[model samples]
Target chain A: MESLLSYAFMQRALLAGFLISITCAILGVFLVLRRDAMIGHGLAHVTFGGVALGLFLYLTPLLVALGVAVFSALGILKLKERAGLYGDTAIGIISSLGMALGIILVSLAGSFNVDLFGYLFGNILAIDPEEVWMALILALVVLITIVLFYQEFVFLTFDPESARTSGVQVRRLDKLMAILTAVTVVLGMKVVGILLVSALLVMPAAAALQVARSFKEALMISASVAGISAIAGLVIAFYFDWPASGTIVAVSGLFFLVLFQARSYRKPAQEELNERV
Target chain B: MSTNSSLIHVDNVSFNFHGLKVLQDISFSISPGDFLALIGPNGSGKTTLIRIILGILKPSSGRIVLMGEEVHQFTQWQRIGYVPQKATLLDPYFPASVREVVAMGLISLKRFPRLLTRQDESSIDKALDRVGLKGLKSRRIGELSGGQQQRVFIARAIVNGPDVLFLDEPTAGVDADTQARFYDMLAELNRKEGLTIVLITHDFGIITKHANKVACLNQRLFFHGTHEEFCSSQAVQDLLRGEHHLVCHRH
Candidate 1:
């Protein structure tokens, strides 16, 4: 561990993991509860297109990915309204279109830019000071949005119709959530990569929900699961030379499996038997 | 009963969606301390009308005055509480404690960038106590029985201490005994707290017992009058007899 800390790239990787994991955990709680985990996957695919477009245009991929992701997120809302499609249909359409567009764009950029593989299966060690700053800014935005709209969000998350009747401005909150999700997805592409980003968004939250009885506890538990997995997974990867992103998501999934099994745990039944006896 | 303390006034209201006339030229007024039952046949615009009154949907034509302001311009939503139909429509697996769900009421009353104060906690406690679930505030909402879950939702609706409460089929899916008990609790709230309640229900059992006023609607204002008047109305007899009856009369 001490030797690993001496490497600047490992330090950068740890910071990147912390930023992505924490923000994803926070956003994931809402998304999982809303049953919109696919939005993360959809936006991540859109990020693929965004990254490919950036490569073709000789521009930074992260900024372009942000633009593409937010626009596509808003576009999903529009399609759901105008085409009268359910959310999954819209996401399916957009996500496929994004991947298709990305494939075409990457091919047009000539020679398939072997570095593009890094974005798919992430190379977290490649993160620089600029990507770290972007991740921090995005994390701040997501956390602040959650704090500002905490009540409205929880209301809408559980029961949107009742929320509307309570004058919570359900439509506005919907848009805000979609946009924030887009930003989070784009930022997540850094540490977890586009291919497995949604795993980071959903697994930790799902794990937390398995044992958490309250929303506040779920949030804290999810953040803990995600942050711990990210750091631990990255450290383990450093020793075994496994890919950081895959290792982190696998670890998150491991946490979920453990929590899922723990859900049925009850105090030793001897006490209950004694009371009944 | 005194009618001078009117809180909601609906004048010549009509609503339609996709060219389907859900309600036509319906009008009513809600007074403070009134336990009013909005009864109707299934799909008779009961929920729609309640939604319009709660400002969830706009009347296609007519105007609504709530708390002395036009519905469109009314901004004091904290003065009202709404418990929607199928309150249990949320997935049963969703995770939230009773306290967290009830505190959503106080949270909704807060504007952006504001934190919930200590007073919000006490209000939550009081609301939970009113629903008889104060002791189970830490329990998962889904862990409760169907009736207790409804009570938690009621607690959430009332935590804001609204002057007017609109409940849509709040006791649906419960057994008859539980429904009666639920209605009795509501009656206590109405009589003791003097909370104006607008209940949308298709069930007639509790209406005659608890509601002082009754509004029978089948896509139009069929009858709006005292419970005594409704009990004596021909429409009630026709409805009870299963006749293809459509009464458009108003009192």
Candidate 2:
């Protein structure tokens, strides 16, 4: 276990895991509160088009993926506001369109040296130095944005009309949050892949919320839980020779189940207290 | 605060939803320090009118002016505060303290990323005190009673020190005593701080008692005037009294 730290790839993978966990955990709180989990999932799938397009065009996959994801997020926002479509409907349409486009593009570009399964299911061992740096930069951007607009985001999530009346520039803030979610989704695809990225973004936050006393505390605890799950999953996967992304998602799922059971146990006591009061 | 004349001016405003007329040729002006109660039955377009005033909805036919400027051109929302009809739509279990919720009112005033300042803190405290929830500032919102929760939302509205405040069915679901208290708080705020208030409510008795002006709405502008004028107007009296008779006869 100690010798694993000596290998550059292993170190890169660990660092990437830490950054991904932190980013996803923070983003998860807003996504879950705003009920935008499906949007994150949709954006993750939309990122596949970016990935395929990059491969076809011989450009950087991360940049193209980010661009496509951002565009999809913007598109969803526009359709919801201007076109009067419900948000979930917009996300559903975009997700299917993106996936169809990706499939067609991949098929058209035959003989390309791309592993479709790796992009779909993720391969944590592929975290090179360049990818690690990219993850770090994306995580930093997300963290700073969250800190900067913490109060605004909280207000908007709870009540958009009140936020707007209070002069929060709600539309602008909504756009910013959507774009940030897109960035996080694109980056998250590298670790959890499009198929399960929202799990990483949502599960730990949901679990942390079960025990937290306040929003701030929930965010902190969720980040810690996410980071722990990533590290533990990586170690377990390495030792047991299991699939990295699958093990990570499973670990997170187990944590959620445990938290759910704990909450259920406490419910009766809380109800008793309520009756006594 | 700007001592501008005619705080809100509605000029021949009309609204349609899917080509069905909702408000037709509605015109009214609310000056600073005015407390106006918008009384109406269900589907009377009260919410629509409020939304139009807040710039959330556009008038189909005419223009609205606020503080001598076109309403559409007004960009500074810090001057206005709004409490929605169903604050209950927010999840009760959301992890937010009363103070934290009130601080959200200051989101527009603060430059991004900065912590709350002394001024913001004092104003929030004052707003909470005004709403009679100063002692429960640390309490989580989920733990509060319905009336108390509404007061917290009111605190959030006033935290920005807004000049104009709009509340839709603020006393809904609250007990009679709590509703009276809520109105008293609004009255005190209007009298002492001179906050312009536009309240949408189904409670006509309270409106007749406390409101300086009243607007009876049902799709179009039924009537708009001072309380005395509204009570004297045959159309307005018929609307309210007819509804009252229907309820009494049903029971």
Candidate 3:
């Protein structure tokens, strides 16, 4: 770990990993609760298309990915609202199109070179300070938005009908959430890559919910679990020269299994009590 | 226009979806301190009417007034509470305690951060007390039985102390004993607390016992009158004969 810290690249990767954890864990809790975990997976593919478009156009890749991801995310919302399609169905259509466009653009830009490969599976060693800064700014925006509308999100997630009837501005909040998730997914693609970004968004939250009895507790535990896993994965990857995103996802998966087991182990006691009742 | 006496007024409201008429020329008014039961057959637009009243759906032709303002423009939503039919359809994995679930109703009343003030806490407590779930405030919402979940949702709806309550099939999946207790609680709320209630329910048996007013619908407002007067109405009598199964079927 000390040897890894000497490399600036490793330092940048850790920073990116930490920020991605905070953003993904926060947004993921809501997505998982709302049963929109696939949105992250879908938007990651959309970000891939954006990255390809950026490279093809010789523009700033992150900026272009941000634009495309936001646009496509909003487009998904529109389709869900007006079009006769379920949410996952809309996600399926847009995400597949995104990947297809990305594949075509990558081919058009030249070939599946090292640079493009870095994005697909993540090249943590390639993360620069600039990318770290960009991720922080975008993550800050999402964090502030979540902090501000935290209660509303919980209300909307629990019962959208009650939230709407109580004048919660359900449409605006949903769009805001979509936009936030798009930005986070696009930025997070730098650290965890497109293929595995949603794992970050979903796994820790599921694990936390296994143990937490309340929404706020679940959120805090999820963020902690996610942040810790990213750090732990980075340390192990440095020693083994392993792929950091894959390692982090694996570690989080391990935590989830343990937590789920613990949850089950505790349930028998409660069930026995219920039987007595 | 609004009057001090009436809490809600549905004036010439009509709704259509994809050219299918859901409600046609429906008109009625609900005054303060009245319990109105909206009863109809499966396809008779009861849910649509509730949606229209709650401003969830935009009626195609006419308008509605909620709490003295037009439904489209009314913004004082905290004064009204709505409990949907699928309230108990929450996922088993949903992680929220009873206190937190009831606090959801106070979201509209408070702004960002939503940390409960002393007043808000007491309000949440009172709501739990009202629903007889005070002892289970810290218990997980998903751990409760179906009837208990319904009461939890009712607690959530009334946490903000709304003047009027709207329930769409409040006991949709509940057992008969639970349904009777739930109906009794509702009757107490209406009679003792004088909360104006608009309930969409299937059982006509309880409606005659509790509801002061009843509306029978089948694509149109077949009958709207006092429950006692409704017994004499030919329109409802015709429906009683036409949809006897629906009237006889209770949870």
Candidate 4:
């Protein structure tokens, strides 16, 4: 492991992996609780169009993807609010449009580049040193925003009407959360690829929720589960020459399964205890 | 007519949803410490009216004055406590302690970078104690029974000590005994603690026994007056005589 860490590429991969995992974990908790878990998946499809546009324009695809994903996230929310479209319905429209745009852009480019596949299936070991710094910055912004508005977010999720009545500025915070989700989805592409980015944002949180007694505990447990999975996936992928993104998601899936099983067994005992009391 | 004594002043408010009129020319004022029971039949826009007053939904026409300020311009939201339909929107598996759920009421009172201080903790404790759920402070909110969950939301609403409280169908799922106790607690809050209340409920018993004011609505403000006046109103008398149900018969 030490020898593996000595490699510059491994170091960048591991750092980016851990940062992105923790970021996704925290944001994922909010999304899952708000029943918007599919937003990450929808935004990732939009990110594909952004990436294709960047590649065609000879610009930084990651930056373009970030811009496109954020706008699309906001658009999805607006359509849901103003047009009164259902959440999944809004997501479906935006995601399909994004995919169509990406298809057109790739066709206009005249050839499918090898680099596109690299993004479709993440090449985390090939992650640049600059991308590692970008991950760190993204994680910091997300962390700070959550810390500042943790109470408001929880309240909004629990009961939006009460939150709005209490003057929580629910709409503004919603846009902020969307932007952050967009950024997280874009950065997550580096770890899990566009095809699987939403997995990072979903599995760990769902796993944590299985046994968590409180919201704070859920957040902590989710972050720990995600962080450990990222590191473990990296080590396993390195030794077995497996795909890193798939390995990481699979590890988190394993965590969810174990927790789910444990919960199922414990529930009957808990019911019996309640009966006795 | 004086806005100074009124906690909420709803003036000619109208709302249209999907091109259907939900409320029309509704006008009422809730004075300080008044226990106003907003009674109506199902789909009579009772919830819609509450949402409009809370600024959760905008009226198509007319104005709402909250605490002498126009509703949209009023930013002192901590002074208003609202308990939405009891546990209707709440996820049964939501992971939050009783303390955490109650503390949510105080979030609006805080500024940016809001952190729960020691004072906030004691306020939560007091709110829980008032609702008789202080012993379950550390328990998961989802673990509580339906009645207990209702009390938790009430605690959350009152944790910040708002001057006026609005409850929408708060007794929908609870047992009759719990509903009675709930009204008693609300009456105590109105009489002793001086908290103004606008309760949306179906129980006529609550209106006669506890509520000081009654607003009978069905797409319009059919009646808005004291309980005695409501008891004697022709529409109410007809209803009580089984001419109709809760919806006041428009002449």
Candidate 5:
């Protein structure tokens, strides 16, 4: 463990992984509660297309992916707000277009490049000092935004109709959320890879919801779960020489399953006790 | 009602959804402290009308003036409270206590960085006390019974002490005893607090006893007058007795 910490790559990987996971988990709580859980997955797919376009044009891939993902996220919001499309339907449509664009771009590039492969499977050890700094800055921005608009997001998620009638700027706040989610997804692609980044967002929140008694507890528990999973996954991957991204997602899945089982077992006993009363 | 003193003035309002005429040429004015019941058969545009009045849905034509300002330009939303339909149908796993849910009602009254004040806490307590749910303020909203959940939403709507409150189907699926108690609480709020209330419900038998005015709507305003006038209106009587079956139908 001491020698592992001495390695600069390992230090960068751990810092970036921990920060990205916490950001994803916090945003996941609101998205899952609002039934927009699929937005993360959709945005990740769009990022795939963005990466491909960047490679095709010989531009900075991460920056291009961030731009494409943010644009697509806003597009999804517009489709829902203006066209009245259902959330999942809009996500599905936009994500499909993104993936389609990616496939064409990849085919046109004439060969699957090693650089693109790193994004697909994630190479945390390959994450340089620049990407680590990017993760730190972006994660702080997302967390701060969540803190600033915490109450408004809660109201908007719980009952948008009531929130709007109460004079809350539901549309403006929704766009803010979309932009935040897009940023989180783009940053997360480096830590967990494009394919499994949604797991980092979804699993912790789903597990936390099982036992959380309040929204605050849910957010806290989710961040802890994700942070722990990231650390555990990294340690295990380093020791066993296994894939880090896949291991991280697997750990999150395991947390969800355990929490789900524990919640189910406790529920019947609590109901029986209530009946006795 | 005098237009100057009216809290809500609906002028030739009409709504269309996907080319389907939902409400047409509807006009009425609500006075301060008046308890108005909006009744109609299923799909008769009752919810749509209230949404329009609340600016949730824009009308196809005409205008709505709230508290002297046109609806589109009205910014004093803190003065308006709303309890939407199926308030009790919240997700059973939603992670919010009754207090937290009620605090959402106070969000509109605040600006950016909308933190609750010490006074806001006491107001939440008083609102819960008004709805007789002060003891369950910490309980998770999903844990409450259907009737209790309904009261939680009422507490939320009234937490801000708005001048006018709108409730859409507050008693649906509740037991008869709970339904009677709900109406009694609404009547007390309207009578003692002078809170103007616009309610949408199918329970005519009990609403007529509590509501001072009744508006019969089925894509058009059939009647808008004192409850006593509603009882004697021959047109409404015929609709209620006919296959329209406005009272017995459920949406």
Candidate 6:
């Protein structure tokens, strides 16, 4: 473990973990609040297509993925608005189609030097300097956006109709949120992989919800939990030669389970007190 | 009407949903300080009509004017406050306190990304005070009783200090005493604050006691006039007698 920090790649991996965890933790709060976890899943798969296209074209995968994910996000928003289809259904369709396209692109690329397995399962130790820069910039952008629109987003999540009547441009905010979630999910894919990104974006927030009494508190706790999970998972994976993404998800899952049990145990006691009063 | 000016004007508006007409040729004008009760049967389109007026839904025909401008063109939504039916439809477990919910009313007035200011905090406190919920400002929304929860929503609606307030069944599911007190507060707001009010309710007894004007709707406007005129109308009398079950009949 001592020698692990000496390697530049391991140091980069640790930094990447911190950045990705904080970003995912913050975005997860909104995703869980909006009940858009499936959209996060869908965006991850769509970003896979973008990554595949980047590999096939010999370009930066993050840029390609960002473009594809944003386009897909906007498409889903427009389709949902026009057709009145359920958001989850739209996400499912888009995600699967994007995945299928990605598979076809990977097959066509044939004999590439890129490690497809790294993107699929995530190899945090293999993160390059360019990818770290991408993660940092994306995290900064998402953080700024959240700070700017926190209140509007909160209102839109709780009661969209009331938000609109109160002069919140609900549709515009909704579309912007979708786009932001897509971008965040795509950026996180490099750290947690397509299959596990949604977990990073959901579980810590769910855990925070069990304990948090207010929105701001929930956000703070969630970010902290995510940061802890990422560092612990990375360290555990390093010492034991385990998959980093799987370990991170498992850490978050444990937190969620513990919080769930704690909440359930306290609920009946609180209700009993209410009854006696 | 003291020449104060009309705030909302509905002209021959009609709406249809899936080949069934919901509102037919309804016309009425609401002045700046009028407290109007919209009473009808369950399918009488009271909610629909309110949504149309708020521009949440578009009428198939006719026009609505708000503050001397077309409703569609009225961009200053801060002037209106609306409470929808079924507050239960919102997620109760959401991690928002009563104060946070009320502060949402001021979101539109601020530039994006800015935190709440001292003035916004004072206004939120005042709105909570008005709704008699000042002590519960820090309480989680899910922790409140039903009546308290409804009052929290009312506080949110009024926090913006709008000119007009619309409530859809604000007292539904609340106890009779709570309902009575809620109306008293509403009446006080209307009379003392000079706020125009439109309430959609199924309770005619309360409507007759409180509303300055009454509109009876049964998929169409059965009557639109003063409370005395509504009570004297033959169609309204038939409605009160349960002759019209297609639309909600307010006594």
lDDT of 3 by residue, A1-277 (tens): 6788998888888888887887899899999998899999999998889888888887888899889889988999999989978999999999999999998987776775576677778766688888888888888889988988888899899889888998888999999999999998887788778888899899999999998888988889899989899899988888997898899989999999999998986553335323432
Residues A24-139, model 5: lDDT tens digits:
99999999998888999999999999999999999989999999999999999999988999999999999999999999999988976798888888888799988888889999
**Cα-based RMSD of the predictions, in order?**
3.9, 3.6, 2.8, 3.1, 3.1, 3.1
CA lDDT of each prediction against the hidden true structure: 0.85, 0.82, 0.85, 0.89, 0.89, 0.83
Going through the candidates in order, the fraction of native interface contacts each one reproduces equals 0.65, 0.54, 0.75, 0.77, 0.75, 0.65
lDDT of 2 at B152: 91
Instruction: Give the per-residue lDDT digits (tens) of candidate 2, residues B126-240.
Output: 9888887787777667767777888899988888788888999998888998888889888888888999999998887667667888888887787888777876777865765
Error of 5 at B35 (Å): 0.8
- For candidate 3 chain A, the 10 contiguous residues with the lowest summed lDDT are A268-277
Runs of candidate 1 exceeding 4 Å displacement: A266-277, B1-5, B242-251
Per-residue CA lDDT of candidate 6, range A1-277, in tens?
7898898988998898887888888888988888787788898899889889988898887788899999999888887888888989888888998999899998897645646677777777888998888888888888888888899888887888888776777888887888788878876787788888888899899999997767888899889888889888888988898988899889889988888887776543335323432
Model 1 alpha-carbon miss at residue A246, Å: 1.0
Candidate 2, residue B48: Cα displacement in angstroms equals 0.8
Question: Candidate 6, which CAPRI tier?
Answer: medium
All candidates' TM-scores? 0.94, 0.93, 0.94, 0.96, 0.95, 0.93
Among all candidates shown, the one with the greatest lDDT: 5
lDDT of 2: 0.82
Query: What is candidate 3's TM-score for chain A?
Result: 0.94
Query: Could you give the DockQ of candidate 1?
Result: 0.45
C-alpha displacement of A135 in model 2, angstroms?
1.2
Write the residue-wise lDDT of candidate 6 on B48-125 in tens digits. 999999888899999998887888888777789888896745576788888898998887667756489999999999
Per-residue lDDT value at A269 in model 3: 31
- Tell me the deviation in Å of residue B163 in model 6: 1.0
lDDT of 4 by residue, A57-171 (tens): 9998899999999999999999999999999999999999998899999998896678788778888899998888888898889888998899989988878878888888889
Write model 3 residue lDDT over B1-251, tens digit each, in one string. 24556788888889989889889999888988888999988989999999888999999988888877888899898899989987868776688988898888998788666667899889988998988878788877777778888898899888888899999898887899889989989989988998888899988777877888888888899888887788667666766785553232212
Q: List-wise, what DockQ does each model earn?
A: 0.45, 0.43, 0.59, 0.57, 0.55, 0.53
* Best-fitting candidate, scored by DockQ: 3
DockQ of 4: 0.57
